[model samples]
Target: MVVTDVSRPDAGSPGTMPVRRKRSRIPGWLRGVIWAVIAIAVISTASYSTGAAALTSSNTASTALRLALPILLCALGGLWAERAGVVNIGLEGMMILGTWGAAWGSYNGGVWAGLVAALAFGALGGLLHAVATVTFNVNHIVSGVAINLLGLGVTKYLANLIFAPVSGNPRQSPVVPKFDTYSASFLSDWLGGLEKEQRVGISDVAGILRGLVTEVAPLTMIAIILIPLSYYILWRTRFGLRLRSCGENPVAAESLGVNVYLHKYVAVVISGAFAGMGGASLVLLRGGADYLENQTNGRGYIGLAAMIFGNWRPGGLLGGAALFGYADGLQLAGGGEAVLALLYGAVILVGVIVVVQLFRRQWIAAGLGVVGAGVLYAIYWSNDTLPSDLIPYTAHFVTLIVLAVASQRLRPPQADGQPYRRGED
Candidate 1:
């Protein structure tokens, strides 16, 4: 946000600029709506134009939702921690702990118990990070790395000690109960018949609406609700304001008599809770048979990416998560439809860019977009599509491109990594 002068004639320290630049003052709600519309336009054009059966299928939709929920939750976790002035790189470790906690809780109590246990374990991990970075003034990144190492070591050691004996597998745990799925075959058939695992009619708005309601995981439902819930709590409420302020400038918050350390601790602990929820989803998404050492993979890191992509906003986070999830779903479902659909989506984006440029009177930019669209059409006419191997992760490429293009629009807390001490201005 601070724009400084690099060139100065006499430069002990260049005085602050007297001139202030006007900035756009778009409301948050309106910005969200705009983002949603753009996302829908791009996704819709890709889905229908390419005949991406997998993208449209009920199974693909279900899978994407499932995959997106965990990532969204983790992103929310990162949002909480970072927004509170703590850079938490230990989300992966917290998630790993949640896997074991979920397994243990499920084994002892039930599915719900698994969730509670996951939260507890994640909270513990968060606490460790907070104690080191917040209380002791350790470097935040160093503390996070330590937590990750400790979590990995402890989980592996415990798995060998406990899970190996119980399930006869050192790397995996025994099965536990999982959530049930609901069916809507009639709706699918009525919606123009499923092309792969879904009915090939995304623009059939009716079908898409019905599809979301049916065959959904309970956790997915929770995650969807949490999106708006997070937005309301973080951006709408007074307490949320305080929380965000703490991240932006803890010293200023402290001057206002805010319990800076307390708030930071609370933010990080909450962050862990959300991450734990994500871990539970990972286990219970299927038949909760076992917890594997490598289940989390790099999803925790990806979640951080999603948060940045969303500009640290909840709704934006949802879109980013959904985009990533869609890619994974196509890969899981395995088909050519997803690949074709992505190409079509690219074409749609090209058109959108050209239209926006034309409206803005950017003739050169508009012309380039037109040219790009023409090339895409030529490819379509020549019978071309994205490679099958790349279909599964097209979203990653999109995420990177988006981040590059809109980097200026995205901002983090001004004091995100600066250590705060009491009585300091």
Candidate 2:
């Protein structure tokens, strides 16, 4: 009997069975958007409980905006690096260094001097990164790790040496002058009840709105403005073109008459300077430029994630940073333990499921996973003690994870990370 096996196709036979074509899954971008919407809906529903209702006010929203500013600035700084073909992993270190410089400068000179000094030192750090990664051709990741280590050591040493006192009293640096919070002023004007002289309660919706708009410094505005400016520079300007070329294909760009080395240097310097400004903002707004060891608190890394989440676009970074900032703000707003825990776990689980489903495209699996997580959170909340103060932290953590995963699905420009070497393809 001339029975042919249907499963196996003969190598040289004309009657070979055709291979089945695999269908393309949904685009990552579309999946991400859908997941994001789902996650937001889940969070909103979870926050609709009586306890969460008490927490959701104008004040809470304002606080979320206020916290978002510094993160936005840091994300911009990171964006500068990534856009120019370098990954800046040392944002945290740059921030710490800037904080130290700004604090020290403010203590001796003034706030303006502190700001300038911070930028200068930040530029210097960028130069170091440039030299290590671009000029010497070192691994960018290792160089960043080195910078973080150096920043930690140097900032700590300076803080202890300068701030630590031999006597009973420790000498400290002056605080940055408070800038007008336009958001707060506008909110107050719009809300119509808050008095200029009245001490508004933090928990009050009006109070929170007032605090965000009124208390946020002018630097925050600067950070927001940088978003558009950065986009223009990166996509519209000559220098930006050269910078991008170097990162995408240095040899090719170098061959095509672009100064790959110089462009890389400029990119790192710009990135470092922005990161430094972010650090200075912290001191000026919150801690004062006095050396606080590890004051940056991983905002630098968060900034990197923001850049990715924004798909390396300057304008998009603002939203990404704000998401993280909102998380941090939620953690700070102190709520009841059980409520906070439930909220935190739910948000995080939703974020994770959304990210995974977006990447893997297992819609059914993802739905089941999220459902399981919700159940687990319910069980845990029934037995565990949840703290209110940790709400913002939990929120920020969940948001950051979401941003990170979403960013991976984003399609960056073709020439994003290659150095522009002249005459090379």
| lDDT, model 1, position 58 | 56
Which residues of candidate 1, in runs, are more than 4 Å off?
1-27, 182-203, 287-289, 350-391, 406-408
Q: Which candidate is the best by lDDT?
A: 1
Clashes of 2: 37
Among all windows of 10 consecutive residues in model 1, the one with the lowest summed lDDT is 192-201
* lDDT (tens digit, per residue) of candidate 1 on 99-203: 888887887798788889989998999998888888998998898888778878888998899889889988998887776776566775555343333423344
lDDT of 2 by residue, 1-425 (tens): 23345445563366554455467797645765675455445544444442353233444555566667656767887777776677788777887788878877766677677788788878888889888877676777888899989888877677677756532223334344433344445566765354222323323434444545655556766777788788788879998888777666666677778877777778889888888888787776652334456777788888887777777776567667767765665555534443364455464655576666757786665665566556545645664545555544555545544443343457665655444433435
Show the colliding residue pairs in model 1.
46-345, 57-198, 58-198, 194-198, 194-199
Candidate 1: C-alpha lDDT: 0.75
Error of 2 at 263 (Å): 1.2
What TM-score, over all chains together, does every model reach? 0.82, 0.74
